[model samples]
Target: MNSNSLNNKALHVNLREADMQFFRYNCGGWKAAATLSECYQPDRCGPRRFSFVGGGGKTSAIFKMAEELSDLAVLSRPGAEKRKVLIAPTTKMYLPRDGCVLLSPRLCEVREALAVEPYVVIGQRAALPASAFEPKIEGLPSSFLEEAAMHADVVLAEADGARHMPAKAPAEHEPVLFPGTTDVAAVMGLDCLYRPVREVCHRPELVCRLLGVSPEHLLTPEEAARLLMSEKGQRKDVGTGQEFYVLLNKADGPEQLCLAGEVAKNLESMGCRHIAASSLSPAEG
Candidate 1:
């Protein structure tokens, strides 16, 4: 049976209940795990310079991660000092709503602001007009990101652009990951399943080339799984010794959750060490 049909076989269930199931199945093997955070190693040091690529909810995931890291008294490893987070994009990104947005012509001034603000979004001024939801911000140069890593405790960089699509195949020059990035998160939307590639994926032409399928083809679990594991696709420019993770975002319903399970299983088989199937929306405190 095809993967699309397999995911459809299961009945929908509550999202909270689905969370635990994927945590168990996707989190390698953790004997005692009640909460989502418990599944991974408490001592596991999070990446100092992290980059988020892929197609699904990259912006939301970036902000949500910054909030989660900021809330933690300790940043990952024990005795680690809790410091502010820096959210800058290697590619263009909308200004964050909750955090302070600072655009300084001089990188020195930007670094100074980061020292006082727990959350600061720093980037070049974009050509677009700033709005309530979509504010203007251009991307920073790779040189700036390499140097900026020294100023913040944790840095989150949106390395790819998807034009708000849930999935994407990277272009020849996409996902400009900086050399200092110690970890990478590849996000894909679970909602992309059974949808036409052209509708849900960015760079549909490239996705078609990589998948060897037509743009009109329905995105299946196996196809999505292949793209996730493919070096030219999600794993592009993944530096040596960098911690890599696949985030199956938007698993809000049982069906999408089930699809995430299938995708995670494939990622695991392809040697993905960490996989998370969850909503990227930041939870209310």
Candidate 2:
């Protein structure tokens, strides 16, 4: 009925096949999915596995979710020990053993975060560079997907665009050949910041009132440049629902908080879902 209950149900459903297969192969006994679900219920002592993709706010969200679930369970029963929920981050970084693992290229950042406290550590193969050969398949790795399905109670993957830059003006100018006047002039530029549609547009807390067009749907860089140089506007309807967000990433010291607050209010007014915000400062006590 509630979000937590829904999540719990999803967890139970996901674990069914894995638990049954594990028992059938190792214990040499037939175990039903329902039995395994009961064994792994919220109040049980069994370890719960939650696998998640790295990057974005997913890690933070999962951490918050774990804390909430634990608190809810404890509140429901005054004298009960909270169930341990393992939070794992899958990247090309160091791997975690018991608590969580970082599995990709950004190893340093993950290591620093983990070193602040004791946690399970494990490492995986480094991520392949973007310049590597194209995949034979269109989607994600089958092995990765199966592992997520079988081993994880909850898997949160960070979805992002291939290449994105914050909204800002260009720092340099390029020389262009002109037909007449024997003179060269610098061109005015428009700075636009790009972000994943789901992260930006769909987020109620960000206060994004308008939908965004994807890079794939937009005109080519050269075409856009030509239009701008000729003082002609190029408007192409990429249709709605491409899933990306854009914003001016720059704001003054006081303006940042003001903007954030405004966005929050707008989101609330628009009936947006799952909105959250946090501020991190090293100088804070």
Best by TM-score: 1
Candidate 2 per-residue lDDT over residues 118-198, each given as its tens digit = 222222433553333321101134344334323322222222211222111111121111111111111111122123333
Q: Report the alpha-carbon TM-score of model 1 versus the true structure.
A: 0.80
Candidates in order have lDDT scores of 0.68, 0.26
The digit string of per-residue lDDT tens for model 1 on 211-279 reads 999989999888898887788898988877887877777776677677887787777888888777765
- Per-candidate TM-score against the hidden true structure: 0.80, 0.32
Off by over 4 Å in 1: 1-47, 73-80, 105-108, 128-133, 282-285
Angstrom error of the Cα, residue 16, model 2: value is 39
Largest lDDT belongs to which candidate? 1
Q: Candidate 1: lDDT of 201? A: 92
